[model samples]
Target: MTEPAGRPPAFRIADLIVAEGPEGAERILIAGLTVTVSAGEIVAVLADDTGSAAALIQVLAGRRRAQYGAIDAGGAGRSRRIRPSLPAGVSVVAAHERCPDGPAHVVVVDATGTRPAESGAKPAHAAARRGGAVLLVTTDAEVAASADRTVHLNRAPRPERRPKAAVRFTTQALREAAAGSLTAAGVDAERAALVARVLVDADVRGHFSHGVGLLPMYLDRLRQGGIDPTAEPEWSQEEGSVVRLDARGGFGQVAADLAAERCAERAARTGLAAVAVRGNNHVGMLAAYREHFVRHGVVGLVLNVSGPSVAAPGAGRPTLGNDAVCMVVPRAGGSPLVVDFATGTVASGKIRHAAHRGERVPANWLVDREGRPTTDPEELDRGGAVPVFGGYKGLGVAVITEVLAGILAGGTVSPLVHKQRAEPERAMDCSQLFLALSPDAFGNPPVEELLDVLSGAVAAGYPQGPPEVHLPEQQERLAETMAAEHGVPVPASVVEQLGWGAVRTAPATAGGTA
Candidate 1:
């Protein structure tokens, strides 16, 4: 492997160390690279700090497992071990690739100077210039000057993972965190634990969108005076099979959980139940909420309408909300079936995440200066909008969501909400609707039997095209199995952004057969 001309040869060797549960293994992969990093040398990663990257860095550093690949850092008994802390003189900076408003500076890690302060910028810049090594992560055009060296880390060629034990612990930790959030907010003992369990379930099911990644949002909102942890959702009756709720600015997860459970309970009594909820903030993972009904042998449908950020189909002008829809169906075996997708080609938060990681997005997913197709995420902050998929068809569905969840639920529409938006917290007054149905309630026959018959028919009547039709949520369910066996495969951007190290522990053969 080619080594950068700074560190000793012993520091540069080809190897791979994948993290695992209980313990990890190593392998000597001729394909892996061991670059020599040194003091005052800048190492830049040209990608976002997404989950995939986060997990990879952990694996590479021997903190996590490797499904395949190994590391050999130097002369050692087993190359699978990590020092837990980096050696002296190494510093990590998530520049996010965008131009710094002024000189580069040390952002104080404390609450008082938390984000950035004007006075600290000069000192931070001077320190870097004085030969303190700085690791800057950013997209292509965002860097104002040449880096000492730049390393490009891209997304995994395909979705992948590591050990079963490590995966379980990670999932369990997330569940405990979720439970802690509720308990701290004064949720009852039993309810808080249940809520935490579902949150962890979301992570194990490979639904990172609603996983531990959302903890900061909860903590931030609570710390920033945006959400009320003590608040509760008060229920009110709407039309037949429909209910209305006021979440009173409480935790979005709590509101969603309550709404979904209530809808499922109603559906068990009646043939169907629909509930609309308003005044809540970010509902962690809709899949977790929907799964509540699915576990009870009920089919659940939910549509979430959020603040204005999406553009009108074909027009490129901001109009409707970036509407999202989620559905869950009970399955007898394996993981439960659930489907969740944003109507926009991509969510705005994802764009913000890309900006934070100093990465560029695919050109197709964004709009240009004149509201044409462009990949730069910065435009989004300056009145640019993300286009809707499937043209008018998708826009039509978003419109339906607005009427059902926003208007009917007594929440502000996109335009009005966007007009009054002063801060990020204020931008989230959107609404959501949950529809639950007990298959057995509608008919005397059991729900699982019908689902099985329908599932078999869907499998038998496959499309001639490449994509197969198993139920709507079956594909994700199967992916869950693999993810459970290994750990969640994080994006490469996440790993490099974290500035950790890795090694190769498994033997030099696949399947540990060496």
Candidate 2:
């Protein structure tokens, strides 16, 4: 490949040697592999297996050192050791992962057999369009044919066998098991049942990260006195349309439920109401609170602030919580329109879930301690931080959430809040805000009709002849229906941690008990 007049080639690898196995008896996986990728070029390296593709990409990513080679990524000098402090310009995307945002000198993709070549090539082309060099490692001939250049590598070892399928449990049985576990951990039976319902609801809706997978963490906090199971949320201060509730470092689910109920009731009488909750622990999912307002025939908005996990723009360390935002609008006879999400690219729980499942994440989801993009799920816990979604726009959402949930609620802010998992013995002191608006207050303008017209207009604007467009929460609602008819699939690893051994022996039924 030719280099630009004044700039170096995007990346140049010469005499690269990758080996595995014992030191002296090492097996030569890749020998004398040389390739050059120029800026605005798409180069494909066809290999036999994903294992080989990943090994070479790892060397390029500076995760592993090549046995013998000289790699100059960008205009940087050639070096065998690519230190962590090296300039940030190279990004690695595994199969099925989305193309990362931001400028990159080189984008390496390991697309061996995990996804179709066409799908993998789309991102490579996108990177090239952005004036970045693309190094695609694939096992498919179609992918090689689509690239600007193709390099072939010899066969490498295959990956290990995949893990067993997750165990399935009936919704009722799973809820019972969760409640029982919570009760055993010293939470009162009534509170345990309430918390279990919230968790199982999340699981059935396909939000596994906030589902019963968190029961173990909750149990630990309860046992360690970080969460007071016996404490009840009470109105600490009250006004006409506004109130403050003290969670007293209790279960966040319980506190949020109470706040939602109170807020809805007050809104019904006053047209609008807001409830601020202080001294709260970790709330599983904001969706659970939406149901209360929906049932009360009102619009609901919920905001929550947790411990810091997201970093500010250009900052290497975390400065704010990922923070959650939820909005629910009651539709006359249909399911409520629910929109729920974290302000970060992804929630912190997602990283934890991926780490627990021994999986890598998309590169854009997190940054290492030095602010370089990473795909490692474990990095979030090691001084790594998640970036705000959509850059500065999402940061604005997080800032507003913190102001309302933390400052306005008179509760601990992100920096002062305790880590839920790492410091389970201390109070998290998180905060939540529940706002309810009575639709009837404004004569209940034809909301259902307006929503229908809006949906139709959106579909009409689509180029593909009125494509099926699902409303927010529609996919989750469908998942909930499917789970009710079939069963909730819980990872075997999570089931083991919950100590529900008998579930494996239960008789199989239509709901997939066993």
Maximum-TM-score candidate: 2
As a whole number from 0 to 100, the lDDT of residue 142 in candidate 1 is 44
- Alpha-carbon deviation at 251 in model 2, angstroms: 0.8
* Cα-based TM-score, every candidate: 0.56, 0.73
- lDDT (tens digit, per residue) of candidate 2 on 1-514: 3334553467666656676753212455565577777777788878766566767766765676665556666643553433432234554544322224411122463222122233367767876766666777766677677888877765223452344467778888888999999988878888999999999888888888899889888888888889988887888888767799999888988888999999988887889999999898988889977778877898999999989889887566987888999998888667888899988878887777767666656655677798765556789989999888877887888889889988998556788888898899988998998999987898978878888898788777867675332456866877777686678877777888988988532234445431
Residue pairs that clash (backbone atoms under 3 angstroms), model 2: none
Worst 10 residues of 1 by lDDT: 22-31
lDDT per prediction?
Answer: 0.54, 0.75
Per-residue accuracy of model 1 over 74-115 as CA lDDT, tens digit each: 212233223543333232222221245533212111111122
Q: What is the lDDT of residue 359 in candidate 2?
A: 60
Shift of residue 430 alpha carbon in model 2, Å: 0.9
